[model samples]
Target: MILVSYFARYREQLNLGGEKLPLDASLNTVDDIRQRLIARGGVWADIFSESNLMCAVNQDLCRLDQAVEDFDEIAFFPPVTGG
Candidate 1:
């Protein structure tokens, strides 16, 4: 299984903070998951909008196309903001 999380506005817009997906289907990279999720349609598809969101795998920021593995905690969010 893999944990997919959303932060900030993305989270609120999707009415979710995170979820875990079964890994039985096999996935290779972050981009693959992103594509699959977006393809699921509805909230995820709308949120992804494009390949322009930020991603973090296991608490470490990474590119959209980075490699991914089982049980990895992956986070997706729009670029952050600060005061």
Candidate 2:
């Protein structure tokens, strides 16, 4: 299984902090996982559609093309900003 987490506005909007999903052919890459979330529609689609959103894998910063595997921890969050 893969652990998916959301942070900041993403967590608030989705009303979910984390969830587990089976690792399968349909979710081989970070982008695939993202697309799946987007497919949920409504708030999910809006949050993930943000081009500046950030994604991480196993606590390390990663790209959308990054490979995903079983037992991996993936995190999605909005871009940080400073005033």
Candidate 3:
């Protein structure tokens, strides 16, 4: 299983903090996982469709193409800004 988390605005928007997803061969990369979520349509698709969406794997910031493995933790959030 892979742990998936939504933070800040994403958490509020999705009304979720995290979930455990079944790991599968098709979920090879962060992008792959994202695409799968997007395929869910509606809110799932809308939240992930943001071009400026940020992500991390096991707490380390990474690109969407970054490889993913079973039991890894993934986090998604919107870009942050400082005043």
What would the TM-scores of all predictions be?
0.86, 0.96, 0.96
The residue-by-residue lDDT of candidate 1 on 1-83, one tens digit each, is 99999898888988888999877555788888888888989987888866569999999999977888788999988887789
With candidate 2 superimposed using the best TM-score fit, by how many Å does residue 74's alpha carbon deviate from the native?
0.3
Cα distance off (Å), candidate 3, residue 60? 0.5
Screening candidate 2 with a backbone cut-off below 3 angstroms (N, C-alpha, C), the clashing residue pairs are none
Q: Write the per-residue lDDT of candidate 3 for residues 1-83, one digit (tens) a residue.
A: 99999999989988999999999889999999899989989999999999999999999999999999989999999999999
lDDT of 2 at 52: 92
lDDT of 3 at 52: 97
Off by over 4 Å in 3: none
Q: Residue 72 in model 3: shift from native, Å?
A: 0.5
Best by lDDT: 3
lDDT of 2 at 12: 91
**Local lDDT at 76 for model 2:** 98
Cα lDDT tens digits, model 2, 5-80, are 9999888988889999999889999999999999999988899889997999999999999999999999999999
lDDT (CA) per prediction: 0.85, 0.94, 0.94
